[model samples]
Target: MGLLKGIDPILTADLLWVLRAMGHGDRLAIVDCNFPAAQVAKSTVTGKDPIILTVPLPQAVSAICELLPLDYFEESSVFYMAPQDGVAMPPEGNAVIDELKSAIATVSSPDVSIAPVERFQFYEEAKKCFAIVQTLERRPYGNAILVKGVIGPDGKDLKPN
Candidate 1:
């Protein structure tokens, strides 16, 4: 088995798919363990409609957010999500969240608003994105939707963080 340097191993397949689907202005959604990804993501490459994936949600997200070259996407559309309930963001994702925010911000098209969606709203948004990865993470309200923005053709190349 091979690996993408710096990306968590748990992200392999989903991250690969994310890198493949997203281009400038495209989007990827990372939902909680309980979130339903199969219902939202683009049809699988294998042509299987009910394919189930098992992995850590945030790690998968962070992996793609951490490594892929930013040659064909937007910066302003990149976002992180958490339940809009009054509680603080899930503790387990704090470091991952922080790292993801910093990494995406370095991009020129990063989303200006890192908005948090209410539980039900997040579900609806998932249906609209390019794909969603249902994580094994059980943290409450652990959801993030990263809108793909164009990677400037004239911008400098990116290295894994």
Candidate 2:
């Protein structure tokens, strides 16, 4: 299989699936260590990330984004979650941001906006994302949400018809 820079190989298959079905406005959540994924996955029983799970949130997001197209020009093409305190986010959060930049280097992802919300708001949104990829990172607020965008008719990443 092909690969993207900074992406870890463990979740490559799942990342590929993210690429195929998710469309603009569709979201992907990269959860931090304590997200209660085990409880979240109770319905499907997709076992939680094992204690031995490797890969950091940034690396996981990078891998998942690879499956996604970089053009997020639609109004809701891409969205991110940060703390509502509105304090300057920490550098760790930028990990995903950097990857997004790299992914969009050759495309347009204006819809790709990172919005800060209350921690609770993030949980609510995370529940509805196209899907969430739980990472092994133990850092707090390392979570992120990304909306999908489409390639424009003119060959740019814009909202789909």
Best-matching candidate per lDDT: 2
- Reference-based TM-score of each model: 0.61, 0.63
Q: Flag regions of model 1 displaced more than 4 Å.
A: 4-8, 42-55, 68-76, 80-112, 154-161
User: What residue pairs clash in candidate 2, if any at all?
Assistant: 24-148, 71-157, 152-156
lDDT (tens digit, per residue) of candidate 1 on 1-161? 57767656665564576567666555566666666666555443332232234655445555566544443323335455565567666676575566556555554325344655666776667666666666665655556777654433554443223
Give the distance in Å from residue 136's predicted Cα in candidate 2 to where it truly belongs. 1.1
Worst 10 residues of 2 by lDDT: 43-52
Model 1 C-alpha lDDT versus the unseen true structure? 0.55
In Å, residue 133's CA in model 1 sits off its true spot by: 1.3
lDDT of each: 0.55, 0.58
Error of 1 at 124 (Å): 1.4
Best by TM-score: 2
Compute the lDDT of residue 64 as modeled in candidate 2: 57
Residues 29-60, candidate 2, lDDT per residue (tens digit)? Answer: 66777786555433221233322236766666
